[model samples]
Target: MDIRQLKYFVAIVDAGSLSKAAQKLYIAQPSLSQQMAALEDELETQLLLRSARGVKPTTAGHALYQRARAILRQMEQLRADVREDGGSESGMVAVGLPTTIAAVLAVPLFEHVRKHFPGIRLQIFESMSGYISEMLPDGRLDLAILFRDSETHGMSVIPAFDEELYVFGHAGLKLRKTATTCPLSALAGVPLVTPGTVNNLRLLIERTFLREEVELHIVGDIDSLPALMAIAHGGSACTILPASAMLHRAENARPPMRRIVAPDMSRPASVCWSHALPVSAAALAVRKAMVGLIGQLHADGRWPGITLRPPPDAATLEDTSGSV
Candidate 1:
């Protein structure tokens, strides 16, 4: 019930040991243990069960830890928003994105945020769109830059821009599909290198292959287009990725790239976040900055064959104005 209690529990869960958690929190091990025991007694359920693997959360502990983490994050966010000059853009932002998008976008976005809002803290992690969606509903992330629609439930979707997916291959390989469109059947004999099927792009690719009864011979399974490009361009295999992916890159150390299309394949980038709660000033500024940057990327013809979704908050300018 108390913030201290919750803090200690969360620390233990993260540290995976009473001793380690105490060390991190700068509290005595016995004192931390006492606090945790008091908490479990108050709840009338064991929050942790010690094991050789380290401290483990029981079924109840698992659920409680999840809620506790969110509560603590929200509390910290609130604290940051209430301090002196809280009205100013300041505090931390934990951002999540899928591997490919993060690989391309996170660095630039980080740089922009730092230049404009130096007080804001930036933490980045690359996962799939699905994982980002799941994390957003909780306070795990202040915002998520992703694709494949919003699964954050109560969150709002700010469509940034869309990019056309192109199949790429080495020069020596005989591409069965025409340059105009990548046919599903064209993947039949090709040794494919794609992301895990669970990934959005891979799921789309898999569905296309299934429709045509094409068995994509996957020679490598990767998580990002950059990695895929590095491997595929070496003539080890072939893969499909957004055309924008290669726009800013240097010539591959191995071979060159040729576009692939089966007649249709496309995807878009989306900035997702919760609408139910007020965001910290830092989070708000970053979101606006990202939208402008994406808009700029589109305008520059960097996103050549893409279309951007509508900017966020149609009725509300809210002292925010800028464009790329």
Candidate 2:
């Protein structure tokens, strides 16, 4: 019936339980239940299905949830615009980063936003790139760094950089030492742990192998970065990933890494946001900050195996520029 009720409903659906949502919203359970009841009554239809296991949204509830999220985002953007009218930017900006990219960029990006745009609150969601890509279209994320090859319909995408993939494993794996890069053929018989089939990186690797007529012996299909790294560290199997994925590890603690040759491999990363939603000043500020920090990192030699894309054209730059 009201924005407050919609917020409560969204919270309940997200938390999957009234008690949990109530705790998160700092409200009494009975009060939350009553509010939901009132909303359902006003709607003239049942919205949620309750059971011992918890709650799930009905068809009508799901439809309302999507619209409510969009409405809330618009309200937030309006508030941000009003706040920035006085020459100060303030609002929440949600950014999505893949696990590998997060290892290299999350901390620096967070610090940069806090130091430069002190009035803006940054929310960094770290997950698999595939999962992160799914959140951008629904107004859940203000911006995301995703693979350039991702499904980006109805979104604005800015190419950021190209990152080379490498083979990583412990010394015990007995991977032949290469002066600079290892041939893709050398890994034909090596046992490997990689992401699942649905992952973009996995698909790329598969296509490359198929095109090159090389045999890829995958021993495990693990989508988690840490788990894959652990399997490689244990000398059980090697993994292929961007060098940025190991940026958080100390040099001595890092596994051996070698660039893949015999037709080098790399993937492009991009900054993306939905075209259907209004981007707030806070979000724009964060996006600019992210791009600048990425360039700085490449220039400082902090980010490895990555080539920064050239600057945007005059027209593109003009489109992205704002008062923030």
| Model 1 agreement with the true structure over 167-206: per-residue lDDT tens digits | 6765235554334555555657687788875677878777
What overall lDDT goes with each candidate model? 0.71, 0.82
Q: In model 1, which regions exceed 4 Å deviation? A: 12-35, 48-59, 128-131, 150-152, 171-173, 176-182, 224-226, 247-249, 254-258, 275-278, 302-305, 316-324
Local accuracy of candidate 2 as per-residue lDDT tens digits, 239-314: 9999987888767667778888888999999888776456666777788888888999889998989988886664
Q: Considering summed lDDT, which 10 consecutive residues are worst modelled in model 2? A: 315-324
RMSDs, each prediction?
A: 4.8, 3.2
Q: How much is the lDDT of residue 78 in candidate 1?
A: 67
Query: TM-score of each candidate?
Result: 0.78, 0.87
RMSD of 1: 4.8
For candidate 2, what is the lDDT? 0.82
